[model samples]
Target: MTRDAGQMPEELERAQRFAWDMESLYGDDLVSVVLYGSAARGEYRRGASDLNVMVLVRELTPAALRRAGQRARDWVAQGNPTPLMLSHDEWLRSADVFAIEVADMREAYHVLAGADPFAGITVDPADLRLQCEKELKGKQILLREQYLLFAGEPAELGGLLVRSFSTFLVLFRTVLRLSGEAGVRDAEEVVLKVAARAGFNPGALLEVHRARASGQPPRPTADSPLAVGYLDAVDRVVTYVDRLVREGGAQA
Candidate 1:
């Protein structure tokens, strides 16, 4: 498809050009070029967010990597992340492991070239829930470590929150899905719903988001740690996921 519902013209054109380039470089070896992440989600910020692309191929080789290295470098130099290259067999086999990412892209992606690899795909709910809990806890650990290291610098502490907010949003979306709240993609709506469901104050999270959007470090909300409320919010989410009934199959 040449267009996605909410994409801006420039973004769409760039994605199409990248797809065309990949096709021209790899020919039939390239299975598909999919646009996902924030850009594909209609949450793109021209100067800030990444335009995440995933290229699926019949086989991934050193030769293939060498061929696309320059183009990938140019793309990253333009402020986007390096394009993700995966083999078709790997894509199918790893769905059980990368369920969170696969399912998100499956739900929100645009197929810029070839066939839609996610068509008819269904992620295992047990895998999704397990990953949800694992990633939530893992992120909580990462945040604590960040806090311990940067506690002295309030602005850097705030920067940690701003940098990590987007990642937390992705995690929150997966948790909501496991909790039976699917299809809530709006940023503020996701925050509100997650706060309601997880029983955390959304204030700190929203503040972090505002700081991120405004391109500034968040102000200290509490005296000591500066991000006390923010850390507490993440902790609550970890605890909430702990109590969740591990759901799977049809009901999940």
Candidate 2:
């Protein structure tokens, strides 16, 4: 099917071209190409956000995978995340366990080619909440272990902070959604909204977002109170979600 790029931004137009390139390689085997994450949601910052793409194929056989793998390398080399390759069958079956991912993509996405896989899809709230909690705590543990390894290095710590904070912001939206508040799509605004709802001071996290967006090193050192405050903010967020889970129960 012919796709239109007339309404999209230059970055997204480029994404559509990449999608068409995949179609050229896979032909009838290509099921769909979609643009998701911040870019599709209209919150993308050219240098700060990734242009996430999902390419669905009729089958992911070895030969097809090899062809797609070549495009994946070139895509990343051009600064986009590797396009997520999933067979059409797997896309239908995986949503039960990957509820949060499906829900997030379904919440906002643009179909660049083929059929819209996310159309009419539904994600179980309980499953999404469970994964959100699991991922949140898992990342928290990773932060502690990694922090020990980079304890005093300002640059390394800053880089870690920049990369890791974005995940929490993504998870934060799900946490808020569990409580029936998913209207906001901007990650920074999501953090502020969650902070007010959960009663944590959003200042430290705001600083982290600022640092990440500016591509600047976090001003505070590993030994500084601000670093400690960042962790404290994470802890508060985790704890708040835990309470919401227990109080609202899994289905809520």
Candidate 3:
């Protein structure tokens, strides 16, 4: 019983209802029920996709996480599927383990019957920006190395192009999150929105996309035209943060 974007509201309501039902049976120990993955991002298909969810609880006794796991398995056995149940410690500690993407945060609604202990959980925008920048720096280095390594091979060039485009999507999504915009499932849509709101040039982003589509070896240089577009996008993000700091100072 998953659905597509148009049917998201109904699906979300059902998920909330399911969370409530679980809370009633399990008592007040449950922290929150988070709907994750593509369905959470309003991209599920009725016939093909399973809903991904995380049930975060205060302290699951050794028996409880196991029981929860068994219950989830049973749900799948019944032809309704969901993913893991995580305790509070696991979720918080794992939050910074990787570059958080649009798919990671979209459609996250808290469904809790009673007072939620995790209600005040806030992901600092500054922290997210730093994490994103760190990831971007790493990807930029990796892409440059890969390009040099297989400069003559068309197949390797194509693979590097794909990786670079994927990294661009991650960078764009991170900017969206920093700006308090909900994550978008579509990479192109996210890039367009980032360009519009974050003072980036959309034409530049489209150029990167076009280069990626061409399946050609990128020109190698310190200031390669292909690299310029991505670099410009990164500059826009830095400019955005600088503007925010200035505006905040003025307000103060």
Candidate 4:
């Protein structure tokens, strides 16, 4: 069972109850219904975050997939992202390809039902670093394209900055971990520390964070000081990640 559902918000409590329903539906075949990501890490924000769950089962047969699919759709209807449904064996074998995800989940997760599927799991730091590099580079290209698409409209650009800043935060945390800074989890603090270490000004990221927290537009217009600073901050981060990748070399 999960740590008292009453401790969570109503939406999360309802999601936990739904996981329990899955346990009843699958019985012995269901290995676990685990809560991961922001909610499990105790940093969840109501109406702004996802309830990420993983449903592991012993088998991945067609019948099992169908049942899990239906349940996942129902869960999505309740405003949660579709749960990751995998067999126990598959989950055990995916560590190499999913090192970053595995490490994050291993750091903090709640076992909502059945056995703990992630227990004793280990992720390779080399694999994690490589993936982080790839993700950072890929995201930088995508961010440039997205900025071009929405830079004309101040509201859209501001919204883009607010929404995509989280992705940058995730990468910042990963880079910090790769650089031997452990147990640093707060998103804003991570950005600040990373900026200081990487020798880039964090004023822009801080402004965006404050605006995001206050539920306001990032700035009056894309040509405004905040938007320009935000783009510069993002560009500097991209350069930082690129340098790390070059230094780490291709050894994964």
Candidate 5:
């Protein structure tokens, strides 16, 4: 997908300005301020999604972070409307647990008042790749085992569907981990990249997504050729990731 420049709505602009004012009021100790998540990814709706952002400081006191969060909530309560304010350190430490995306606006990122914390943060690409490989492999194993148990049990389709969603979640997480920089909410964006790197075909997986979106039942039994095909594709994904890790280690 093509990257587009961030276009702030008037309300968002007001929120940003308010954030900047808060930073100044607290003195210029704000190390960095970033817009992140879906809003940063250009997928957010003005009224539906809250403005997600991160405020970084050289030394963010627990009290300070709490105060900042409260202030943001209070501002939104006043009808300014935007759930803004997250601390950078807190965000980084918990990023792996949640589906948060980093904003990609290095050149045009409005500094507001301080330096960019990411300016010198060197993320090792190889390390990221290996971490994602490990995580994806683990997820594949779990999904395979779960699907095997659910097979032929059409009555348990709902549970199976939830598990299938989990499969997509794991795949999405792996992509985010590999990229280091996040903001990929759509599975379509990273599925191909992950599949190619791990030697799995994305087409088959996409079929599953299409079926799910269409509200069709997933095939998980041997009787259902589609289900069997999906399972086979998933297995291949696991094997491919395992081989990649093994080969990479041998080269190292």
Candidate 6:
């Protein structure tokens, strides 16, 4: 089963145990087990973060899936998200379509067992751009819709900002990569850089993060400048990415 903590050591131990379990369970069929996302990047927060793992097997059959289902439930029961299960062939085949997530995995990951699964795989640049444009535009629409529902609800508005903040950072990093930029992983730094690039102030985004770190959830008033800035920053990122010179870049 999975377990999380207010600290890091024990969490790492849990990941290690998971790796050992998978190695034993699948043996040679197990291509690799990797710990990725915030946990692998050293940015995991005790109560807010999840331990994301990637598992690759030689092949995926009904029997393999059945086995995974059994172990996935065990892992999820312990408060961890289900591991990303992929077959070696599927991993290579779906590279382009899944580039955005694979990009993050390449950015930071700890190999638990076997060799790195991404070692020789390639993600098409065109596919990455297509996904980014699609995702940003979709999120922009969702934000507008969510704002309507939360417009008069201060606490909920703040919670929306608090919740989606990290997700935007990941999007921002991928956007920056699209612009040939790299090496800025800190949340504050990423916000500031992306805001400047996409033409928005970082104040509101920074404020939401501060509130979360203070151990008190921020409840920004519906019309508060912080709330307005939060929406504007994301809106501008959508616009900026849409204007990039690539196929499907400008979605009307």
* CA-lDDT, candidates in order: 0.82, 0.82, 0.58, 0.78, 0.53, 0.80
Q: Rank the candidates by TM-score, best first.
A: 1, 2, 6, 4, 5, 3
| lDDT tens per residue, model 3, 70-120 | 566665675556645667777666544532632245334343343442343
Give a tens-digit lDDT track for model 5, residues 1-252: 112214656544654675575676456666666654435445444443445555666556777666566677776776544543445565455333332122223212344445665554443444545655666667667766766776768646434643465345445544444434254456556666656655666665666655555556454454555555555666666666466556653111
For every model shown, what is its TM-score relative to the native structure? 0.92, 0.91, 0.51, 0.89, 0.54, 0.90
After superposition, which runs of candidate 6 have C-alpha atoms over 4 Å from their true positions?
Answer: 1-8, 246-252
Residue lDDT tens for model 4, 1-252: 455888877756866897887887789999998888778767777666679889888998999888767767788887888888899999999888987778767767888888988777877777878888788778778877878888788788888888887778777777777777755777678888888767777887888777776777564476777777777776776677668777873222
* Prediction 2 TM-score vs. true: 0.91
The better-scoring model by lDDT among 5 and 6 is 6
Which window of ten consecutive residues has the lowest lDDT sum in model 4? 243-252
With a 3 Å backbone cut-off (N, CA, C), the pairs that clash in candidate 3 are none
lDDT by residue (tens digit), candidate 1, 42-106: 88776657789999999999998888999998888877788999988888888789988987787
**On residues 99-204, what C-alpha lDDT tens digit does candidate 6 reach at each position?**
7788867888888888888788766667778888788778778877888899888888877877787777788888887777755677788888888889999999
Per-candidate alpha-carbon RMSD to the true structure:
2.7, 2.1, 7.4, 2.5, 7.4, 4.0
TM-score of 4: 0.89
In model 4, the Cα lDDT at residue 41 comes to 66
| Regions of model 5 farther than 4 Å from truth | 1-18, 21-25, 45-52, 72-113, 141-189, 196-234, 249-252
- Residue 182, candidate 3: Cα error in Å is 4.7
Tell me how many residue pairs clash in candidate 5: 1
Q: Which residues of candidate 2, in runs, are more than 4 Å off?
A: 1-8, 250-252
Q: Candidate 6: worst 10 consecutive residues by lDDT?
A: 243-252
How far out, in Å, is residue 166 in model 4? 2.2
Query: How many Å off is the CA of 220 in candidate 4?
Result: 4.6
